[model samples]
Target: MTDSGLEFDLTRRIGGFILRGRASLPACGIVSVSGSSGAGKTSLLRAIAGLDSGLSGQVRFAGETWHDGTCRMPVHRRRIGIAFQDTRLFPHQSVAGNLAYGAARAPAGTPGPDRAEIIALLDLHPLLKRAVAGLSGGERQRVSLGRALLSRPRLLLLDEPLSAVDTARRNRLLPDLRQLLLDHGIPALHVSHSRAEIAQLADHVLPVRDGQCGACHPLNDWLAAQDASHPFSLLEGHLAGHDTENGLSTVRLGEASLVLPGLGEVPAGASLRLIVRARDVALALDPVPGLSIRNQIPVRIKGIRPQPGTAYCDLDLALDGQVLTARITRAAADSLSLETGQSVIALIKSATLDPAQE
Candidate 1:
């Protein structure tokens, strides 16, 4: 089969740090680049975009050789749309002017959203005529994103795109950003430090550690490898129905079902992704009655991992072939004598379930 994704084995040296980035990322969907400060995350991105002249080794995208032992492609020739943390908008131009410039430079027959669609999607209609110098940090980032989208490049690279936006605004924009990528079939490499962003936006995770970028992993596997403090699992389902009276929504996942906070605005039968935190799940030996918790799923114990020197243990559960995690005190595990293959009830409070656009 022909390889249809990004493949790179790059090396660069910045000051005293030697950076190595190596990965084979999918051709579609969002891939999050995660790492700490000074870990070469930005450097890796610059190298891929052909901005790092000192970069050495191979870089290929969808069978196209961007960089090789002796040949190198120019940045513009690579046809990538990039939004940096600095929000590199043209200072002298109005918001609309910057957006128009991007549109004008788009290569003929490039496939993506049109100018009107992008302006509405990013809520840029109101700020179209405003000068770039007068915009707020969040507004600047939004404009930067709008410009990039208008270009309709084959690949998108975002470096902390939403960092300047407030939590509430960021939460609302994330879904729209994800939908845009999916709708246009634009593959992206998103660099973010926010766990919520990763959970909501990432289809695959590329970890940068100790100045090296690692191979991409599925979202579930990446979450499993995280520490207890970041224990989260993703569940995919379709919205089955909604109860307007009680303000709740029902989602169908295979043979299993879940009750979540009212998502009435979302049409019935729409696909949804649910984020469940391990700490919010309670385990019980038997089904309890008359509880406020809305979801009581019958799951079989798959495995147990005890956190050393900590009071808690993470239980891997199987519910109709889907995996759910529960974190409870070690004492509770001993008292219940939980064992592999034992069937138990997993209690989840409906309010704690966060639904994301899929």
Candidate 2:
């Protein structure tokens, strides 16, 4: 019997740089490969995709071996869809032609969106007849992504797939892309440098550092382990109601509620994932009347850690079993006499709350 999911232990040497990666990932959901530049992030993906002949090690997916000591499966035989940052579309092909090429290569009876659905999802209708040479950077990336999805591969590998798209558009597409991957039951290894992208779409994080890829961690666990400088929290809740006059939406998080703006149009009861930066949160001993902050939640101080070099400190606040991180000056924390298990209010500006695609 073979094991399910993806298991890999790959190593490669490029000139003086050596890359080592090992991980056992779930067979579903988006797994993000995150790191800074030249961290061997892409090299790891290439080794798994069978694009690196110099790589040595094993790559097993869903119990099938793609790479091992002597035998090596060809890249095409691996049945994986890949989209790179450079948007490598065929120069001679039109947008439709490029899409058709990917569609033609899809395995028979593969599970995924059909050609028409892909076109619609990427909004490629108008650009279908356009030449690839004329497409903008963002448009090319979209087309490349659409083509990858059209192939209906069992596994997807994306290397900074939306780096060329504007932030607003990328944010809008992330939710739909995440849903699509789920709907099709395609497990993806997504590589990105953006924390926002990983926070919004990744179910798990695979950290690449110093030319090595570490074991996977759940998104929240990974976020909590980071330093206080870029601390953040990911919250999940259902849209409780919308106040049209106030142009705000209330999200129910167990017994607590968070009010946010620009969510009035989101249908009631829709699930939402919110990203709250630690810097954006403030703590108060008592609720202040007529404050500009729209969200004030009752929370308990779970833990506090001081930043060694800075005068600031990090606080772990708990609300109805959910954890929120906050960074405040040591003076303020001392002035209020903050301590573990102490109840306080977490004040968040409505505008500062960024709701990710549900």
Candidate 3:
């Protein structure tokens, strides 16, 4: 996950709403653009693709300038491919036909996309002969991705690609999407409001807020900072192991074993970050016996801090070198005799950890 080999600084004012942001994307893997609704996420993507005209600023790719405040490049001239939430594949075409459309439209002298490679990369061989209208939501998305790949664009933009699918459908298609971006070495700009989508797929996080581009960090750090409005903490670890049949994984955090929902094909030792909401964790003075809950990490209370208007107090736990924040009612803290330096066990469930927190 490196930069997109491009630099962008653009500003477009549409009436009272204005979108002003800048980013330096690496040449490899995926970069995510995230923010609350109406925060210019979509407009930014459109501007880069040349779909939104009148955008002023610089859009530089490689060493060539694409968009300067004074000059605008037409959409067809830019070597960028985009896949929107609708995935508008031609209704009369088959899966293969749709992909071929992209190949046919590719610029002359450009290295045409290998049909076999596109088919295999997206696992679309099974549906090649199927009618486009008959495809499932996940299947449609895969075909859409294949079509985009066949276009041989220098940069790919995905706008909330998974928002239309149900959870089961998303899970079914995620592995293919991951391989498409990683195995194929495709540089992409992905836009989404869903934290989980950004967490699992993006390495570089670009947070857009109030029509401005803020600091960029690894996906995990960005998510942790989001839940500060409530009592929650962020933790990052390696994907130690997974039980596909059960859809769970044993996550390694320092010396502790934290099992959570399995992220498909997350290679062993792959870094995984989780958001542990304050309400999901329980504190115990001593280890309880015969518990089905999986996470029971030894914690030493650091201190308690008060949040305005809330009856609960934020408890800081020293788990290895990382601090875990927990929100508990002040009454519960006093009843359990919890205080600074008190030895305790933090109880958590594998189901409670949100993958998007990463």
What is each predicted model's overall lDDT from 0 to 1? Answer: 0.84, 0.85, 0.76
lDDT of 3 by residue, 27-77 (tens): 777889988998988888888887876788898877777889667777777
Judged by lDDT relative to the true structure, which candidate is superior, 1 or 3? 1
lDDT of 1 by residue, 256-291 (tens): 888887466555675556777788789999989999
Among all windows of 10 consecutive residues in model 3, the one with the lowest summed lDDT is: 349-358
Highest TM-score model number: 1
**Backbone clash pairs in model 2 (N, Cα, C under 3 Å; residues 3+ apart or in different chains), count:** 0
Off by over 4 Å in 1: 228-231, 237-273, 283-287, 297-321, 327-345, 350-358
- lDDT of each residue in 323-343, candidate 2, tens digit only: 888999999999999999999
What stretches of model 3 exceed 4 Å from their correct place?
Answer: 1-5, 13-18, 25-29, 35-39, 69-78, 101-123, 136-138, 150-153, 175-185, 204-218, 234-255, 259-273, 283-286, 298-324, 328-344, 353-358
Alpha-carbon runs more than 4 Å astray in model 2: 229-231, 237-257, 261-272, 278-288, 298-321, 325-346, 350-358
